[model samples]
Target: MVLGAACATLATVAALRSGPAPHEDGSGDGGATGGPTAPQAGQALAVARQEFGLLSGGGWAQAWDLWTPTAQRAVPQAEFVRVNTECRPPVGVPYVIDASSVPDPTTVRVDWHRADTTGSATLSYRAGRWRFAPDARTLADYRPGADRLIQNRTAAGSCH
Candidate 1:
């Protein structure tokens, strides 16, 4: 009885942590309906928060994975890691994330304010799930003499 009860509790916790059951198509949508579901929308915000936590925790490579393909290409892996780690938010420890709005079923905006600074990031639905700034671009002349064609789009701002 004790063993069964423990197993049941663990299962319940796992289920709660995992959130909604994704569709058979694995879109995390309500399944067969059409657009993004409540669970999927909640998951998007969760992903956005996870990305911020990853960055604050110094998981540079993992955080890099959160960027869109365009953003990834705009900045080289080494350069991205260097710049981000160098410019990490001054927020001391136990970084906080406060999600404000989901502009649409497919997008979310989360905020962070600390150490006398405030910033935010936006995530959008992609092939199947949420991603940070699925259309990030670099600042003008961010790369000098690299001959890289600049993409002009909303940049994933600081600490994103």
Candidate 2:
């Protein structure tokens, strides 16, 4: 029985592998269009806006939930929230998601202008939703491009 089960599993795996790969779901997540569709791009922008809303409202933990898996791995949940709170000012000022560029189905670059300053973030898509994907260690370990994306949200500062 065990041998038979193993053979069946092997056959199933072979059959699945012989078919189309998983990335070709045709929703444009990773299909022939080579990038996200217009609607998917718009969805990414909406998610970005939602994140900003959460940040400005002092929803630290909720805001952290918007981060990509990779980013979240760099810090624990409480640490992520604490870092963000300690870096940026309170979010009540007028801010515009001035630009959202979708270079591929999996990635979107978002820019926002708030008061006299501008900030940006690169978001990655998975499970039909966008997550903020900033590459960094601690708050200040940012290269120039990353510096612009989060608009220095991780810069050295006091929460109040």
Candidate 3:
């Protein structure tokens, strides 16, 4: 199962690199790199790609490291490990972008699928970058009864 998940992760990364080049605002004056202005949607896509790379490379710590701070605050590493262990799907072609859009400059919504599971995640732009979380909403907004697509809410774990 781990092998399959790893494959999935790699496939996802490859898909990302093959897609359109990402554009971010070069707003950071004075030798700053990877600045904001990169649309929130683009930033979310990049984060997802990095997460997949971490998983594919047997770098669970790195993969977890890619999660948003908000996500980290919401769910810890132990739970992340547990959920990933249970949810890792079988190896298949990496999930396509399915669809992506920014509801607002600060929020990005992406619909993604792998084999049997399909879901969407909401990301927020912070520090001029994007981070994934449970839609940046109230617990009630994330409740299964409230949103059907929020299949998982596990956050990124620690680097170590």
Candidate 4:
């Protein structure tokens, strides 16, 4: 009986040390919350923050690099830089991450706002890393007239 108890204790310790059990989909349960693990969420949020930081800091090319390959294919680099440059946000404007959620094991959806502008972006985990994935509407709006659209969306002259 003592031997059996020792073995059981060892097994319990091992399980505890092994971290949270993965769900059937092979994603960590994040301890009863039913979403991406904390590390996964942090990584995704870090990507979102970094992308926005780069954009706000006028590192447009670097910010564009954070985009998922699929999003990059949908929106060319030059066009993205051009539109954003034309409607750059004011210096020191703060963007708040409103909320984030796991849409899937490999995707995080982040809702954010800055002054009068609000948006949602998807971060995809692929190739062992996270990347920003703009939605279809965003891709469509990043065209030649995007400056006017962005200015109109934000308080007049706020994003100019």
- lDDT by residue for model 4 (1-160), tens: 5345334533543443355555555344535655544447767777777776666557778778878878888888998888767666565555678999997878999999987889888998765457789888778887555555576647666564
Query: Which segments of candidate 4 are over 4 A away from where they belong?
Result: 1-39, 144-155
Best by lDDT: 4
In TM-score terms, candidate 1 sits at 0.56
- RMSD (Å) of each candidate, 1 decimal: 9.5, 14.4, 9.3, 14.2
**Candidate 3: residue 108 lDDT (0-100):** 75
TM-score of each: 0.56, 0.59, 0.52, 0.66
lDDT, candidate 3, 25-144, per-residue tens:
422222245433444365577676556445444455556555567666665655555444444423233554588888887787788875455777776665444555654453233233
* Best-to-worst ranking by TM-score: 4, 2, 1, 3
Candidate 2 ranges with C-alpha deviation above 4 Å = 1-39, 85-88, 137-159
Residue 27 in model 3: shift from native, Å? 15
TM-score winner:
4
Q: Report clash pairs, candidate 4.
A: none
lDDT (Cα, tens digit) per residue for candidate 1, span 55-155: 55566676667666557677666765655455554322434565568678777777876445567777777545566773333422234333223221113
lDDT of 4: 0.70
Q: List residue ranges in candidate 3 displaced over 4 A.
A: 1-40, 52-59, 86-88, 91-93, 135-160
Candidate 1, clashing residue pairs? none
- Residue 64, model 2, lDDT: 72
**What's model 1's overall lDDT?**
0.55
